[model samples]
Target: MTARETEWISIPMTVDVPYRFAAGRYLTKTLTQLRDNGRIFAVECPRCRRIQLPPRIVCAQCHVRNGRWVELPLEGTLVAFTIMFLPLTDPTTGKPHEPPFVYGSVRLDGCDSVLDHLIHAEPDRGKVWVGMRCRVVLRPPGERVGDLSDIVHFEPLPDQSRPGS
Candidate 1:
């Protein structure tokens, strides 16, 4: 009856739960546009003028219905990122994204929210950084399937240097 033995132990496990549901009005419109035309769309909050991606029906801040549709440019800035050292399964495709990959949240120009996706860049610290300019790389129109996966990944734009050097 030692105190160390009485301490709680933690265990990690993976649970595979398969499910499907409808992508309501807002998201459906966003995905459809990406799939059909390779265009990105978001909803603007009438009151606050905040543009949201993966458009939602109501504004999370203003509590008003989002009506105005805004087409966002493919280019944006990387707001945050991580170099993953583990092989993580992509829930959307059920495939494992190999380790040591770079992924991050990108705020597309003129939009308030950010999109998270893989970044096609070396995982070296000297290469990727916050505020890196990037562009969405989408699958060809005919190959798209109306899902976020329609976007292959974000590619860093050329001729840009880090803030300090």
Candidate 2:
């Protein structure tokens, strides 16, 4: 082989890096309650009175210490959503989930912050609407871990139906 053609080609490799995260005091309380009691908890700002999920010590908007803990209802309004056609890898599990699934952001009742998660609705606009009502469906208490993934998905309420149906 000629000297120019003898160049070695480098191959690309993927590394799986494992890491651990400590949920702070506020989040630890929220997650513990979620895992143990199967209930959702949010923190509220003393000044602005905005309730935020993923309970944090400080409120982002008001820039004040969050002092109040609120138990949020499972039901919420679907504020935004999209039909994901791409193979998206779930960072938590480090696995690529199947494509053409519906995922969306929901604003839980009595909470200012929105939570993003998988929406258990058909991948069609006709089935999913922006103002659709949804409730969180969590994994069984025994199967639950102290993480957001404990929520299996948000399922749409059966209030709306097709006109012909």
Best by TM-score: 2
- Pairs that collide, model 2: none
TM-score of candidate 2 versus the correct structure, residues matched by position = 0.90
The CA-based lDDT of model 1 is what?
0.94
Worst 10 residues of 2 by lDDT: 156-165
Runs of candidate 2 exceeding 4 Å displacement: 1-8, 162-165
The lDDT of model 2 is 0.90
Superposed Cα deviation of residue 141, candidate 2 (Å): 1.1
lDDT of 1 by residue, 6-125 (tens): 999999998988788899989999999999999999999999999998899999888999999999999999999999999999867779999899999999999999999999999998
lDDT of each: 0.94, 0.90
**RMSD (Cα, Å) of model 1:** 3.7
- Say which candidate scores most in lDDT: 1
TM-score of each: 0.88, 0.90
